[model samples]
Target: MVFLGGGMPWYAQFGCGGGGCDRIRYMKVVLQRVSQASVDVVNELGDLDPTFDLQQIGPGFLLLVGVTDEDGDDEIAWLAHKILRLRVFEDEQGKMNRSIQDIGGEILSVSQFTLFADVRKGNRPSFVGAGKPEHADIMWIKFNEALRSGGVAVREGRFGAHMRVGLVNDGPVTIVIDTADRH
Candidate 1:
């Protein structure tokens, strides 16, 4: 499924400075899986751009979830169990034998409004009808807790942070799940 990390605004580092300033340092991670998987993370600081940080983590996949008005307790519960149990990685015997729990992998869930960005209208995207913060926050917390209860360590990006994200697609086997589709 699609997951998003809410990041700090790109302008937060500059305070009041306008455009074309030096880029700030931030973390952007993307994971792809099929028979094999690769994760790429860029640390936006230092002279070396697109720095690789995947070596620090273990064998695990990242889940990107989008929050909407229709997402609630049940949706969170279902997704938590499903993602944690998904057997995408192989075990010692060369069998697909590990879940997120078995590998001690954690998840980073971020609140993303741009996931719902409507591009059909014009060059400028429209997010006029996204879920309100009140509803989105409740679901966001519930989803994170549900994943945690399944024995997966979880870390998260800040909510409503303006962030610059970079992703590289290896296998291109991305999955998108809609909470509304469950109902």
Candidate 2:
């Protein structure tokens, strides 16, 4: 389940206040546990927003989480358990039945605050929907703990830091899961 967005396309604009220049649109690709079995997140920062582009490379699953100020320990636990149990892959018999735990995969968890960026009433994006820095940090730590407690070997990008992420996709099998959907 690879999530991609057709972001603003770049075009040549000439004859303005100063001059025109060519610009390439910015895009992000989040490759989760496509090479491993299970992925988990204990907080909302792990969540992926609608604009996020996620690709599940190889055989593992990609866990996209959306963090908010309202997120708590309960939400973190639920997300971890849900990611481990959600079956989106096919089994040996060609049946769509295999949870992350059943296959023993790895997870690539990224801290994406942009997932909570809201643009309801203005041109600029609003982060009011995302959790506060202090709260999010605590939740982020707990979220990873939940995954570890569930016997998952999680590989995560740094939290609250701008990171240059890169991935080499093999099988290109991507899936998206949202804990909020269960509610």
Candidate 3:
């Protein structure tokens, strides 16, 4: 058996055989049903950057997304479809039975790698589980494109940029999803 990185055997963790590791990829998303949402690009010190801002959505979802190093199209596709079709909005009956598509709502998608923070070790969170900036940018762009192509209007946060996200979570409905459990 071969070991990679730390002391653990590589095959056990990443499913490596002889050639390479088929490490499972995952994406984490926190979805909130929102009456309104917006995003603003900012500097590390939290001052807004004048170059970009997504105004606000009248009604839709605020999505905070995190991608793992191994995440790819498979995770992106599944998540995009799930978000668009998730039945958390209201119908005429006032029950949660309608989807974003059913009501023609918008989406505010934000790249939020902080979702992968591992706080088990101490007070300070570790971000080692999060995907690198370059790969995360690709996944973020693809996610927005997927939503658009699937007929949902998507407003996005600047990929790989520091951002401030603001939202009024409708019904205070929040859901956390990880692609690792889907299979």
Candidate 4:
């Protein structure tokens, strides 16, 4: 079993006996119902690089996503299905009865490995639960594609890049989903 830099065994954790990652723990997503959302790349000097504007969306979801070593297509498929059809938007009677698909909403997805930050020990957070970069990047890209396959417009922040993300929460509605909770 080959361990990565942080003393986390990537090879042992993921049962990639053949080639690709077929199993996973949980593909997590922090979904915020938003009236607006945007993500811009941060330059080396810790400033927003106007030229590298990744994405912005109006009236949709601001998704902060994290992946685990075991996360794979199942997690991606489950999350995409749940999020796209989630009925958080209001209907004619001012009740939350509409799905994002119903309102033709958009999605601004950002790769957020920090979502898995482990703060159990001390002041410093550990990312041992986070997916290795190679796997996470692949799964994240597939997840976005799955979301797009739902027929809603989707935007994304650059993977593995330092980004400044901003959003205006609509209804202040927020949800955190972890596939581990599946029964």
TM-score of each: 0.61, 0.63, 0.83, 0.84
Write one digit per residue (lDDT tens) for candidate 4, span 1-183: 667788876765557444444445577899999999999999899988877856889999999999998988988899999999899999999999999999999999999999987675689997877999999999999999999999999999988999989999998999999987764
Identify the candidate with maximal TM-score: 4
Report how far off residue 105 is in candidate 3 (Å). 0.3
Candidate 2 per-residue lDDT, tens place, 100-143, comes to: 77877666666677876556456998766566788777777777
Better of 2 and 4 by lDDT: 4
Top-lDDT candidate index: 4
For each of the candidates, give the backbone clash count.
7, 16, 0, 3
Model 4 CA deviation exceeding 4 Å by range? 1-25
Return whichever of 1 and 3 wins on TM-score.
Answer: 3
Cα lDDT, model 2, residue 53: 37
- Superposed by TM-score, candidate 1 places the C-alpha of residue 123 at a distance from the truth, in angstroms, of 1.7
> How close to the true structure is residue 47 of candidate 1, measured as C-alpha lDDT?
31
Which ten residues in a row are the worst by lDDT in model 2? 20-29
As for TM-score, the candidate ahead, 3 or 4, is 4
How many Å off is the CA of 54 in candidate 3? Answer: 3.5
lDDT of 4: 0.89
Estimate the lDDT of model 1.
0.55
Weakest lDDT window of 10 consecutive positions for candidate 3: 16-25
